[model samples]
Target: MKSLTQGAHHIGLTVADLEKSAAFFTELLGWNEVARNEQYPAVFVSDGTVMLTLWAVKQEPSVAFDRKSNIGLHHVAIRVPEDSALDQIHQKLLAHGVEVEFAPEPLNGGPMRHMMCYEPSGIRLEFIWPGE
Candidate 1:
């Protein structure tokens, strides 16, 4: 037997603020708004290779995602082009006032490095740099 499915088409994330989330991708991450659905109140963003659908929460007082207890997405790991890019982006995140869980450091002991942070809408994101 063989695997029948292809890779991910797109990832959907529920956000507290639609506009803020969209801005995070466009302004901060340099992604483009590819499409929008008014009825669903969602924004589709792409960085040329990957697409993510940001959905607005329909209700107020929504609960935040807890990686320890919740059974959903832990974090979205985005790959950077080079090792130094990780530090560059980390500085950008700080200047933009994004909440960083930690600064860029070794992934385990050697090669790859990574950092953790939360976007404006509280979505956990991990940026990684695979060493050459």
Candidate 2:
């Protein structure tokens, strides 16, 4: 069996407001929209390479992120570039009162960096720099 079965197909994120959430990703992460709203209530976005699809959930369900109660998935990791950029984004997250799960850490030996945070509905998200 293939350990990873090729690369990630896509990432699905449930959000309160599809419009707002989609815009946030496009703005903050510079992800361009590849497809959107073909399903009436769902929005699909991409960065010309990776796809990020957002589903509008009427009532967001409890997630493991709330307390490791819900199971199956832990979080989604996002790749970034610079450590300083991660630190600055962390500051903005704090200002927004976004739930930050931990302090940023150096990844891939040292240069790469990462931080964990929760979306409004308690979905764990990891922002990282996947070093070469």
Candidate 3:
């Protein structure tokens, strides 16, 4: 096996609305698609260093809310550039008719902002700044 120091790379998740979901990440997070394989039903997006991939899965929106059976996947938190960016994200989410997971707040539990939503298949997603 490769050494543990090799480090981790990307995280992949299957989503219902591939284009819309990809837009949600790229447009909101400032990522761009660099690679794709339709046969795999997935595409990779990156910002020079970090890479994110979303797999296309055909499913209904209700899937995002139910997890009692498998608890399949919880939530994915993508770190944004700053603490202030979340406010802008929240507004955008509203414009798009998405709900907030809990109101946005500071990482230290103070008052700030963050973007939180469930994808078309009910998988959890988040956008926030990394801890101080």
Candidate 4:
């Protein structure tokens, strides 16, 4: 059978604050808000290639994300163009008062370097750069 899936279209994440999460991605990743829905309480942002959808849940209580215990997403990793870009983002996230899990470092003693952090809504995000 022919492959039905082409590639990832978008990633939908549940956030406590729609505007805050939207702003975070826009500022950090340079994504632009392309669409929004008040009824669904979602904001869609894209970096001219991939789209990320942030869904707001005001009525429900927020639950902290636990990668080990949770059955869902562990983290979302985005690729950076260069090794220095990872550090650049790390600094910006710190300036924005965003929580940084750790500074950028070599991944598993390999050429790849990565840094992990949490978005405003408590979702773990990773920025990685694979060495040349």
Native-to-model Cα distance after best TM-score fit, residue 115 in candidate 2, in Å: 0.5
* Residue-level lDDT tens digits of model 3 in 1-132: 877675438878877777877887677657789888888788788866667788887555434445566655557676777776777777777777776675577655654346577655457777777644
RMSD of each: 1.1, 3.3, 3.7, 1.6
In terms of TM-score, how similar is model 2 to the real structure?
Answer: 0.73
Model 4 TM-score is: 0.92
Tens digit of per-residue lDDT, candidate 4, span 63-103:
77789987999999888889999999999999999999999
Q: Across residues 84-106, which tens digit of lDDT does each residue of candidate 1 receive? A: 98888899999999999999999
Against the hidden true structure, what lDDT does model 4 obtain? 0.90
Worst 10 residues of 3 by lDDT: 58-67
lDDT of each: 0.92, 0.73, 0.70, 0.90
How high is each candidate's TM-score? 0.94, 0.73, 0.74, 0.92
lDDT of 2 by residue, 1-132 (tens): 758687777888777767777776676567787777756578888866678788887554633334356555688787766667688778877886778988688766676778899766566789887654
Q: Who wins the TM-score comparison?
A: 1
RMSD of 2: 3.3
Q: Which residue pairs in candidate 3 have backbone atoms (N, alpha carbon, C) closer than 3 angstroms, thus clashing? A: 64-121, 64-122
Best-to-worst lDDT order:
1, 4, 2, 3
C-alpha lDDT of residue 112 in model 3:
39
TM-score order of candidates, top first: 1, 4, 3, 2
